[model samples]
Each structure stands twice: as C-alpha cells, then as structure tokens.
Target chain A: MPRWFYQLASPRWCYQITGKLLPGFAIAALLLIAVGTVWGLAFAPPDYQQGNSFRIIYLHVPTAYMAQSIYMTMAIAGAVGLIWKMKMADMVLKCCAPIGAWLAVLALATGAIWGKPTWGSWWVWDARLTSMLILLFLYLGVIALNSAIESESTAAQATAVLVLVGLVNIPIIKYSVDWWNTLHQPATFKVTEKPAMPVEMWMPLLLMVIGFYAFFAVALMLRLRNEILRRERRAGWVRELLQQQRG
Target chain B: MNNKATNACHLPELKSGEISFQPGRIFWATLVRELNLALRRRSDLINPLVFFLMVATLFPLGVSPEPSVLSTLAPGVVWVAALLATLLSLDSLFRSDFDDGSLEQMLLSPQPLFVVVLGKVLAHWLLTGLPLTLMAPLLAVMLFLPAEGMWGLMLSLLLGTPTLSLIGAIGAALTVGLRKGGVLLSLLVLPLYIPVLIFGTAAVEAAVTGLPLGGFLALLGALLAAGLALSPLAIAAGLRISVSG
Candidate 1:
C-alpha cells in the first residue's frame, strides 16, 4: 500500500501529488471519452424500436448514473469529515458540489430531450422525472447553502448535514418508477438480472460508464488541487510551486 | 446501625426538593412565555394571515371567474397557498431572535435547549399555524371546495400544519444568520414538505370525490408525529452551528 493516499490528507502533500497526476488523468480522460463517444455514436447499432433517438441514452444513462453516484460520494465524504474531522474529506465534499450539480443538469437536460422524442412532450409529471427534479433541487440546495455562509468550516458542516438529510430522497427517486404507475419506463439495466440489451448496446454503455468515471476522477483531482492550493497558499511548498510556475 | 438510621432520616433533605417540578409544567411555562413574545410582536401575528388571505384571493383573478374551473383547481390552489403562507410564517421563527441577542440568552439558559426550541416551535404553531387552520374553512369556501370537505380540510390542516412548522424551524434555524435567507429557506424546506403536500391535497381531493378520508388523514397524522419527535433535535443542532459561526 503506497502512503500517498493517506499522506494526501495533508494539504501540501496533496497539492504536490495532484499537480503531478492532473495532466495524466486529463489526457487519459479526454482520450477515453473521445473513443467512447465515437464508438457509441457511430458504430453502435440503432435500437430496432426507437432508432437513432435511442442514441441519447448513451449520454443520458451515464450522466444520470454519475449524478446519483456523485451525490452518494459527496455524502460519504461528508460522513467521513463529520466522523473523523478529516480536512481532506471536507475538501472533497466542497469540490464535489459544483461537479455534482453540473452532472445533475446534464442528466435532467438529456432526460428532457429523451422525453420529447419518446413521450411526445418535453416533460411529464412521472415519478422518475419528478424524483430526478427533486434531486437537482437537493444539489442546488447544498451548493447554495455552502456558498451563502461566510466561514469555510461552518459552510462545510452545514452543507454536510443538509446533504445527509437530503439522502432520504435518493432511495425514493430510485424506487419511484416501481412504486407508482409512472409514464417513464422501468429500469432496463440491473446488475443481478441479465441486461435487456444485446452485447452491442451494453458494450457502448459500459465503455461510456468507464469514461464518465475517468472524467470524474480527472475533474475531482483538478478541483481538489485548486482547493488545496487556496487553503495552503501560505505554505513554503506552495510559494516554491508559484515561483516555479512564474519561472 | 444508629448512624445508618440517622443518614436514612436525612436522605429526603439531601435530595434537593427545589428541582422536582413536573416536566410538563415547565414545558407549559416555556410555551406561554413564547406565546406572549409572539403576541407582543403584532406585525408577526398579522402579516402571515394577510399574506395567506391575499394568496387565496389572487387565484380567482389569475385563473378565471368561472366557479367550475375555480372549484376544480381549488384543492391544489388552497394547499399550495397554505404551504406558501406557512413558509412566510416560518422565516421569522428564528431570524428575529437570532438577529437580536435573545437566542444567545436562551442557549445559555439552564433549561434544556430542545425543550426551549420545541416551545418556540409550538408557540409558532399556535399563533400562526392555528390561525391558518381556523381560517381554512373560510378559504375552502372561497376556493369552491365542496361544503362537506370543509371539515376534512380543517382536520387535515390541523394534523398537517404542525409538521410544516417543525420542518420549517429546521430550515429557519439553518439559515437564521445568512443574509437574504428567505429564498434559500424555501429551497431547503420545500422538498421535505412534499409528503405533507401530497397527502394533504389527496385528503381534500378524496373528500371532493366522495371517497374515504381515512387513509390520507392517517398518513398526515403519522408524518406530523414523526416530525414532532425528530425535527427538534435537528433544529437544535442547526441552531448551535448558526449561532456559533
């Protein structure tokens, strides 16, 4: 077990390490997502029923998955910060908010676009759509709460509590389709049960999922680096790094 | 043996008799004091009521003068108006005390803070929430809800609005110190208020359609009980952070 993961709790060490890793992750993310998009858009077979409109699912599903997972990630980071008083965990939670909100927006936009073609309306008051709208509001609430406060730590703690409370909505959003006679369709992808799609559709989706994760990792590292530098601006290593950049 | 008997004889004196009042009496006293403060602030008492009435009256102009259309939209319109009215009342629940020094004084008081917060919340429910419940029957008529659903509407409001107060207290406590807190307060609390809104409207809708009100009212009552038990603790914790920071 390399010590860098634990050592990164210190702002100076995290700043130094992520500075090295950011470029690599960025390049890798760009390459992978590009390949995934080309493969998904050009090569993947159109659905026998929905045709080209089904292509939106490639972006919609992955971002929706990321939106939900990132919230859980933020909440877990918040729990860690609350329990162990870890500065890195708090930093991660803060950095996660805007990224999560943007991802939520992407999910909602893609969802609405998908709805227009499939359901003949831009929006519907179905369970899945309603719950996802609520999720977007929860993200906005956390981000708004975090920014409105003057003190960093107070903002962090307050937003953390809000995030935990808002977690109540997550399971509801997931099961809304099942619990109600929603206009939206039931989930097609399940881990335990066999997938509904043939290998062609699922493979592109799988690649896109991996690409989304890589993109998230790259974005998180960049944001975390910026946060660490801002918090550690007075440190000697930061001063040296600044001098090096200036040179 | 004689010393033991002497100690036993002194046991009642050793246990302080001054702190033995019933908890219920203390709660009542706190609630009374909160109510008195609320009444002394006349604007707080009247403003939310006026806002509620204004909102209910606006619907006819915004929609149509036709009774059928108004009656059809009445249940949702009234419940949404009430939710907004409750939200307006909620903004002041902690903001004023927080702005002045009163919240600090209460926090420093030897009384348990949860009891104190709960007392304020109850006073809020009585002064603002109770009035809404009383006025609901009149508004229900204006919105053209069936005459029979009036009682059911009142019953549902009675059970439902306290939960609104409790949940709103949590939001108000969280944002008490922030500048321009009103919009954020709505954003934070509205999602939590969904179950109440859903069941409340359903109760009215059921009554209008001549269906049974038992299930919806039961759900509303359960939600209120849960809010009463849980929200105070969250509000208290939020209060400490808001004040300390």
Candidate 2:
C-alpha cells in the first residue's frame, strides 16, 4: 500500500482530522451565509425586470450549484471506492446522498417560488428546473438503491456503478432537456448568464455560493464522521473511543 | 433447462478455463435457453403487448376521445406507453436465472460475461421491444395518429427500444439478487431512459409537424450503439456485485 493511501484510508485518522476541521467550516458557513443573505436581500439593487422576486436567486443559484457539485463529488468518491477499494470512499458516497438531495429540493423550491413571480406560474417546463427536477429523482434513486441492498460492500459497488452511469447521462439529459424546452417554449432566465451584472449584485451571489459550499463541507464531515463511527464500531480504536466517551 | 447447468458441470472438458475463443457457441446457447424459457411462459412474452394496448386505450378514456385531440397527442402517447411497457417487462430479465442458479454458472464460465449478457438482452429485446414496435402502428391508428407519422413512430420505437433493453439490463442485473427489487429497478433505471425517450418521441413529433426527423432517428441510433458498447459490461459488473454480495 502507498504511504499516503494507508493514512487516508484510516477511519480513526479521518474521524480525528474531521473533528479538528469541522469548526472552521461551520464558522465560515455561518458568517458567509449570514453576511451574503443580508447584503443580497436588503442592499443589492432589485432586478430591473423581475424586481424583488429575483432575490431568491441568492438561495436558488447557490443550492443548485451545490446540488450538482455534491453529486459529482459522490460520483468521484464512488469511483474511488470501486477502483481502490477504499472503504472511506463508500462512507463518503453514502453520506453525501441525503445532503445532495436536500440541496436539490431547496433549489427546486426556490426556483418554483421564483418562477411564480416571473413566469406567472409555480411550475413551467423550464429546462433548468426540469433538469434539476430530474436530478432530484436521480438522487432519490441512488438513496433508494443504497437502502434496498443489505450488504455494505455490495450496496457500495452497485451504487458506484449507478452513479457513474448517472455521471455519463447528466450531460446528455441536460442537453436533451434544453433542446426539448427550446422546441416547446422560449428560453427563460439563466442566473449565471446576465447582461454583465454590476459587481454589487454578483459579489454577494458569489459569497452565498461559497457559503453554501462551506456549509456542505461541514454537513458532509458530520455525516462522514457518524458513518465512520457506526461502521467501525467493532474496531479496537472505536471501542476505546466509545469507552472514553461513556466515561 | 435447469438441469443443463448441472449436466454441463459433469463434463470434464468444460471444466478447463480455456474453452477456446468460441463466443458464438456460448451466445447461441444462452439466447436459445432464454427463448425456450420465454416460450414456456408465453404470458410473459405477450403481457407487455397487452399492457401496451390497454394503456393506449386508457388515454382515450382519461382524455378527450375526440379525434383532433387524440391525433395531436398520439405521438407522445404511443411513445410513453411503449417506454412503460418495456419497463414492466424488465423485471423478469434476470430474476428467473438468478433464482434457478444458472446465472451463477454463467458467471463461473470462462466464456466472456458480456457476450452472454448480450444474448440475454437480445432475447429480451426480440420479445418485448420488437413486439411493441410492431404493435405501435395499430395503436397509432387507434389513436387517430396522422397517416404521415406512423412510419416515424414505428421506426423510432424499433430503434429506441433495444437501447431501452440494453440500458434496463444493467438495472435488472443489479437488483436481481434482492427479494423485492421491481419498483426499485424502475427507480434506478427510469432516469437513464430519459434520453432515449426524448429522442424517440421527438422523431415522431417531428414527423407530425412535417419537419425532418432523420436527425432524431440518427441520435437514437447513436444511443443504441453506445448502449451496445457500454451496457453489457456495466450489467456484468453489477451482476457480479449483486451475486457475490
């Protein structure tokens, strides 16, 4: 085994490491999200067209970005688990699913809330939202498959394959849905694409995006630590740690 | 047929790992065995077609039965129903083999796993996808589909559904080991099916609108080619994981 890999694969090492790292990310998430939210909501100028409803972009864009990023991370972790047989990678893959799904839900809810004011309805088959909706289904599918399979290693391998397949399909789905939307309806608003937003608007958006990712990191570490403890409960170190905590 | 596995096990020559590079022989045997099994349970073969027809019938009842409304919706209606029928029949693709232990034998065989998986998917496509494609014209007429679009609907289905079987096989192989995997199989596979569904339906929609549909059909062909190249390997890996775990 490689020297670095051996250390990286150690559950005790990761648990201890994350314990040291979690507070920093948690604090960063709190400060950045708080600052970005207030600045965007109260200070940033309203959209020239959609007006105040556009404020939801701060929440929607960041979550939508995190939702896809977390899925990609899960896929990468799953691939590592399969190729290197890293048990920690499996924990990372499993732990990321629910958080990714929640982010997708938040993005969708915000999009729907935003859509009601701009598009005149709660839901339109807008390409981005439609693709995000399908993404939510994809996340749910991974969660469902993981729960259905009883054995840990087997479930991990199966989900690894599913996630990779999803990774291949995502771009194709996005393109096809985009094409379908164009054929059926005119193009709608894109948060990332604008007529060169003044820095006053985008600065807070960037902050919120970074904040959401920091929050994601904090949540992921918490879940990964819990999973490590649960899966490694039979290990000697885990037993000793449990005894110490009990005392 | 279940006994062929046990009978083959007793043949000393077959026990050697080097069974020559005769994938043709293995492929034929697997396909024929699947066909025989499918033939014996004739209902399994015909049920999807029946389900397809019944679902198409419900559209008329659930929606307006007037011809104008039906014709406008026909392409989407036929395509979505066909996709569902393919999914309904996917549950049995690997379940019986897994239950009967032949799947384990195939896994143990030195012959390539992908070839045998291809044979099984071929057999599945032959029974389910072909029949649905053939049945589409009738269903299209029943729905008052425009005369010009029938060829596009049938051709798109013919090209689209084998891809469905190929992709769906990966899902089937992954779940075949579980006690209750039918719904979970759909959950796992349906999102992957979206691209094929989109292109397939788009072809017919293009035909109805008098637009060139060759591009859409070409995309479906590309998806099928990709599915052919990739799906069996994924299914083979999934099967190994499912069985060993």
Candidate 3:
C-alpha cells in the first residue's frame, strides 16, 4: 500500500485531511450549484415538448445520480473497512448512508414535482422512479440496521455486510423492475432518455451533476470529521486537538 | 493390561499432527439439529403457514371478492404473502442458537462456517419456505387464480423461496444479537426480496395469460444460483460479527 493509504487508517490523519479539503469542496459546491440553478431555471432553453417544467431535471437528475453513486461509494468503503479493518473507511460508510438516503428522497420528491406536469401524476410506477424508491428503502435499511445495534463497531461491520448484500442486489432489482414495468405498461415517453439535446440544455445539467458531486464531498467530509472526533474522543491526539481548538 | 494392549493393536492407526475436518458431517449435523428443533416447536412450524393463509385471505376479504377481481390480484397477492411468511420465520433462524451459545461453538468448530450457514439456511427453507410453497396452491385457489397459473405459482414459490431464505438468513444473522429485530429484519430484507417477488409474480401472470413462462423462471433460477453461491458467505460473516459482539 501507498503511504497515504496507510495514513488513512489513522483517524487523526483523516480528520486533518478532511479539514484541509472541506473548504475547497464547499466553495466549489456553492458556486457551481448557484450558477447551475440560475442557469437551468432561467437561462436554459425550455424543452421543445414539455417547456419549462423540465427545469426540475436540474435538481432531480443530479440528486438521483448522487443517490446511486453515494450508495456505490458506501458499499466500496464498506468492503474496504471489512477487509482491511480501516476505521476511517467505516466512518465514511456510516456518514454516507443518511446523505445518500436524503438524496434519494430529494430525487424522488423532485421527480414527483416534475412528474405532475409531464406524467400528470405525483407518482407513477415508472421503472426508474420505482427503482429509485427501492434504492431509498435500501438506504433506510442500512440506517435502520446500523441504529439497531448498540455497539458501534459491530454495527458498522454488520451494516457493511448488509450494504454489500444490497450492492449485489441493486442491478438485479433494477433489471427486474424494468421488466415488470414494461410488462405492465409500456413507456410512451422517456423523460431522461432524449437522444440529443442542444448545448444550452446539457451544459447546465453537466454543471449541476458536477456540483452535486462536489456537494456530496463537502457533506461527507463534514460528517466524517465529526465522526472521527466522536469515535476517537479518547485518543491522545483528539484530546490535544480539542485543547488546541479551545485555546 | 495385556487385553488392553491387544485391543489397541487391533485399532486403526491415527495420523499425528493432522486435524480431521468433515464439512459434510457438520453440515448434516446442523441441518438435522435445526430441523429437529423446529419440529419440536409446533407453533413455530405452523404459525407462518397460518399467516400465509390469512394474509392471502386478507386480499379477497379486503378487496372485491369477485372472481375477476381476485384473479387479477392473485399472482401478486400470493407472492407477497409468501414473501412475508418467509420473513416472519427468519428471525428464529439464528436466535435460538445465538441465545443458547451453540452459535459460538459452531463458529469455533473445525468445520467451514459457509457449509454450516448453508445447512442452517437449507433447514430454514425446509421448515418455513417449503411449507409456504406447499400451502400456496390452496391460497391460489382461494384467490381465484386460474388453473394454468397454479403450476407457475407453485414452481415459482419452490424456486424463489429458497433464495428468500438464503437472503433472509443474512438479515437474521446480522440482527441476531439485537433484542428487537423482527421489524428491523423486515426492513432490511424486504428490499432485497423485491426482485424475486417481481419475477415470481411475473411468471404467474405469464402463465395466466398463456404466454411462455420460461424467461421469468430462468431469472428466478439465476437469482437462486447467485444466492446459493454468495449468501452463505454473508450469513457466516454476519453470524461472526453478531456472535463476537
């Protein structure tokens, strides 16, 4: 392993690095999201068919993407924690669950808002939407499992195992859900599956996606920093750091 | 002393510094022990079957009981009921062993934990899922499911519930150390159960509509194969974590 890889196992080092990286991510997230929201809502040309109601995609797409990506990241971090006994990885996994769950919720809520105008309902049994809902449940399961256990490390390890199981099921769930939806109702329109879009539309979408990722990094680092302090409160460096902060 | 020496000379030679490990023996022992224990608790054996029947009955009573309406809902209703029944029985998969400390002994034994876990899960399927599959045909008839769909329901349940048992074992093992795990176990396992539920119902629907049911059954089989290949490892890992904690 590389030197930094080994260093990551040390909670003190992880806390220090997250502290260093937080400001950069926060700034980038703030600037990009502000710009992306303004541009997507006002400046971006309306869809030829659905008009301005499509602006919700700016929020929905990014959050939906982040929801799934954060899950994958959590599962990977879980695997790393389980395999290598990395406390930092466990912390990362723990912090990712709520953020991911909220993002899944945001994605679903935004999709509903967008759906009312386009699909003419607050909710539809659309494949992507249904799978997104399942993803949210998966996140809730992880959170519930983690909270149910009293011992922190045991909770982390057990939820890691569950996360991995969820990881393996995700693709299977997605495929089966798609099959089920098609069997019941053939989709007439695919909102996100437009073959081509002019640059004016996609650019903001790209910016929003990047901003969401940066925002996730900011959120994760913030939570992970607190988690490190909480888990390592009895360590000597944590005591020194607290004293330093107090002074 | 002379007679003892003659008897020892007649005995088979044993290898020194070599440990004997028989996974087959451990697997059978765990399976038989789990089966015997489950059979001894008649309510544990029968309650899920009753729940399966009651839940299946609920749809007809709760919804319109007309044959057309019941037939339309039958596939999903039967599959969902079976799924819940399996989940209901999963809490006991590791609870008794964990409570009595044999779980720790199983972990410490010379046998591979994977085989041991698989044996327990197989035993779980036989006790809970197998009974649910057998009773499903009655529920199908009660729900007004078509005659053609009966085979599909039975076949799908037969193939799908084992996978459900396998996956549910992971949740059960993970939560075995907790005091209140029943509701949490459902929350954890149900999402994973969705795919099987989807495919299983789809197969029944196809059969009802006279479409070929090969593809959905194939998918269910694939899931069972994947579960067999992978879930034992997860169950074993969860068991270890729970036991150690």
Question: Which candidate leads in DockQ?
Answer: 2
DockQ-derived CAPRI band for the predicted complex in model 2:
high
**Once superposed on the true structure, which residue ranges of model 1 sit more than 4 Å away at CA?**
A1-8, A20-28, B1-26
Chain B TM-score by candidate, in order shown: 0.88, 0.94, 0.92
Compute the TM-score of each model's chain A versus the native chain A and list the values: 0.94, 0.91, 0.92
Top TM-score hit: 2
Put down candidate 1 lDDT per residue, A1-247, tens digits, no spaces.
Answer: 4676578568877776777988887787787778778888999999898888988888998888888889999999888777667788889999998888898899889988988888899988888877777888888898899899989888877777778777867988888788776687777688689898898877878878878887898899989988888988898988998999899
lDDT of 3 by residue, B179-244 (tens): 999999999999899889989999999999999999999999999999999999999999999999
Candidate 1 clashing pairs, residues 3+ apart or interchain: none
Candidate 2 vs candidate 3: the lDDT winner is: 2
Among the numbered candidates, top lDDT falls to 2
- The weakest ten consecutive residues by lDDT in model 3 chain B span B1-10
DockQ of every candidate: 0.56, 0.86, 0.78
Better model by lDDT: candidate 1 vs candidate 2 = 2
Question: How many residue pairs clash in model 1?
Answer: 0
Real A-B contacts recovered, model 2: 0.85
Residue A84 alpha-carbon offset, candidate 1, angstroms? 2.9
- lDDT by residue (tens digit), candidate 2, B109-222: 778999999999999999999999999999999999998998899899999999999999999988999999999999999988887888998999899889999999999999
